[model samples]
Target: MKHLIALATALTLAAASVLFSAANAEANERYGKQKVVYHINYDGGQDDKKYRGARRNIQNHSNAVGAENMDIKVVLHGNGLGLLSQAKTNEALRGQVLELKGQNVAMHVCNNTLKGRKISYENDLFDVFAEDIVPSGVAELSHLQLQGYTYIKP
Candidate 1:
């Protein structure tokens, strides 16, 4: 009976150690590195919930990965352009964008929309750069996914 009790105790300790190690490894993996693409295609006017959710999604993602440990990109296109519209680019939006930028989040606008809507990037966008403009928004999301980026259309 004593030997059996000792064996059981040893087995329990080994199992506990393994479980602890596995949990630690998982935590490390979560913070190591991650890539994600947020797809925003609906106009804020028509889809207020989605727009708000997208911002919340960004915040939640940042919270999840410590913001500093993850790479995030928000791809805006079509009606989604409203989110970054010159008129809509208020202090809150700019602050959020700037904050995310500081956290290494890249915001890419759709060049196709700019061309189709005759929107001047210089006058219409907040802090978007030329290189940040992708050829097509949908295609960009697909490409990012293919490149192992997790897509979140919030």
Candidate 2:
């Protein structure tokens, strides 16, 4: 009777462990495969509360879902292009942007904004490549949504 009871207890513990591990893995997978976009269009400088909040939000999202397990993009246009402009002069803000980029977050700028603002990526922005310039910010947002990316406005 003692032997049988011990065997049953051992089996039960093993089963519980397996079930817990599987559930944990599934939870990770759910977050890991998510595609999300962080949209910024406000016309505030880097010191603005709203702008800072948006950056915090992006970092929080990446923290919740492991950055490597997610596809994250930040669409910058309109006043949002301020980040690029500030990055040219602000070392702290530039460091943060670089950190996010290092974690695989793609930061895009609108070409229309560049034209309207008379800003050149080469002269005004830091780290933005020509390829990262989209024709229109709103249109790019719409296209990304169509491609199943969840949009977040911070």
Candidate 3:
């Protein structure tokens, strides 16, 4: 009787462990393949609340979902480009943006903004790739949504 009871208890424990691990694996998978985009199109210059809010939102969202498990991209155009400009070129904001990028967050700028504003990527921005620049900001947002990326208007 004692041996049988011990065996049953051990089996139950093993079963519980297996179930718990499986559940955890599934939960991780829920965000593992998720694609997200954060939009930054405000024009408040350096003192813009919405611009700051958008940055905070992205940080919070990445924190909530586990940045490593998420495929995240932030699209900047019009005034949203200001955030990157401040973060990249400005000595004060550079560290913050670099830390975010360290967590696999990619920032894409709009080519139209560059052309419209006559901004030179080579002289103006940091950490942006030519390939990452899309033709139009709004159009890129639409295209990303079509590609199944969840858009957050932060």
Best by lDDT: 2
Error (Å) of candidate 1 at residue 43 is: 1.4
Residue by residue across 1-154, what tens digits does model 3's lDDT show? 9999999999999999999778657667675657998888887354655656766888777765666678888888987777766656466466667877898888888999999998877667776778778899899889989999999886
Clashing pairs in 1: none
Candidate 1: deviation at residue 72, Å?
0.9
The residue-level lDDT of candidate 3 at 43 comes to: 70
Residue pairs with backbone atoms closer than 3 Å in model 3 (clashes): none
With a 3 Å backbone cut-off (N, CA, C), the pairs that clash in candidate 2 are: none
Best by TM-score: 2
Better of 1 and 2 by TM-score: 2
lDDT of 2: 0.85
Cα lDDT for residue 146, candidate 2? 96
Give each prediction's root-mean-square deviation over alpha carbons. Answer: 9.3, 7.5, 7.6
Two-way lDDT contest, 1 vs 3, winner: 1
**Reference-based lDDT, residue 38, model 2:** 84
- Compared with the true structure, all predictions reach lDDT values of 0.80, 0.85, 0.78
TM-score of each: 0.74, 0.79, 0.73
